[model samples]
Target chain A: MVNEVIDINEAVRAYIAQIEGLRAEIGRLDATIATLRQSLATLKSLKTLGEGKTVLVPVGSIAQVEMKVEKMDKVVVSVGQNISAELEYEEALKYIEDEIKKLLTFRLVLEQAIAELYAKIEDLIAEAQQTSEEEKAEEEENEEKAE
Target chain B: MELPPQIQAQLMQLQQLQQQLQMILMQKQSVETELKECKKALEELEKSSSDEVYKLVGGLFVKRKKEDVKKELEEKVETLELRVKTLEKQEEKLQSRLKELQEKIQKMIPTAQ
Candidate 1:
């Protein structure tokens, strides 16, 4: 009986460790989602900017170059696999919007996962408490019998 | 000197759940890291003012048009986003199973004060 209780205690400890790790992962995901949302907003604003406007473009970490938009109608877009094509401004905006939709969907999925993890962790905590109580009761009963 | 069969089974289930949770957490960490990198790349691309951009293809930087680089970054971000979604779905399923197993054990074990 003592051995069995020890095993259960070990299992409970393992479960607690796993739960902590998962909680950390959820926190990281929250930060990632926030960053992605910010990036999406920036892209949307870029789409709305007027075509014939001067913009400061970063050349490097410390250098910024000012350039006037000459061809707002035709913008180059990467097709995939390192291939790019010239696309109209509206088309590029549409493409970006689609990407943003995908990101939002992904974020919803992540939120669902975190919720499920929390539920599981709650159940585990309850189970651990029950196991510990059982172990204590068994030990007390043994001591009483000896007395 | 043997544990009750029921108690042994409960321990096994708990161990399995712990392992599953560890695996899911690892996958989530990797996906989150990849997503961060994709977002950073997109931001850098957006800030560039030059028409010419260099794209990393097969471990080499190839000259590409700025709009094309932006599009590529967008595509990468989309792909990573989809990957994260799939991993999250898997995590949800695993957690549900773990919860079910835990509840079953709780019911089987007699409550002690």
Candidate 2:
């Protein structure tokens, strides 16, 4: 009986450790989400900048040099593997929106996987508890018989 | 070990869950790091106002027009934003599930005196 309890205890400890690991992942994801949101906001602000507008551009360090935007309608967009193309402003925006949609789809798949894992964890915890309680009851019955 | 079949099955399930969780966490970490780098690069691009911008392609920086670079950065940022939202949703779902499991475990196990 003692050995059985110990075995269950060890399993419980392992389960808890895994749960903690998942928690740590969630924390990291939260931080990443914050950074991504900030980046999005910064990008949106760029839309307000007009063509031929004078702005301070940063060099290698913190220092900035004044520069003028020649054309805002056309932008060179990176397709992948170091290849880029000259595209109209609207076309470039559409390309990015499509990429975002793809990411959203990927994220949905990930979320589904996480949900499935959570369900499995719940089932395991419930099973462990049931096993533990049964063992406890058996132990009590054995003690009563001895008495 | 002479364990009941039910207990053995439960143990096996727990082990499987542990492995799955580890794999998922590894993937999550990689995605998070990639998003971080993308955000940093976008920030640097935003700070620079020069008409000429350099993009790193295949381990080499190629000079490109500033407008093009900005558009690329904006698209990257937007894509990352959607990704981050999805991650947040997953986090919330996991958190609630964890809480439920903890409560169930507490009920099953006797507290240490």
What DockQ does every candidate get?
0.08, 0.06
For B1-113, candidate 1 gives per-residue lDDT tens digits of 56568867887988987798788789888878877866765664564445776665786667877776677677877987888888788888888988888887777666421
Model 2 - which docking category?
A: incorrect
Best by DockQ: 1
lDDT tens readout by residue for model 2, B1-113: 36555545555655555555566566667667766766655554554444666667667778888677767766876776677677666666665655665554455444321
Q: Candidate 2: RMSD over Cα atoms?
A: 15.0
Where's the lowest-lDDT run of ten residues in candidate 2 chain B?
B104-113
Q: Name the regions of candidate 1 deviating beyond 4 angstroms.
A: A1-52, B1-113
Residue clash pairs of candidate 1: A76-B67, A76-B68
Report how far residue A64 has shifted in candidate 1, in Å: 0.7
**Candidate 2 lDDT, tens digit per residue, A14-120?**
76666666666666655655554554454455557766678887887989999887676665655542435555666666655655565556556655656666676
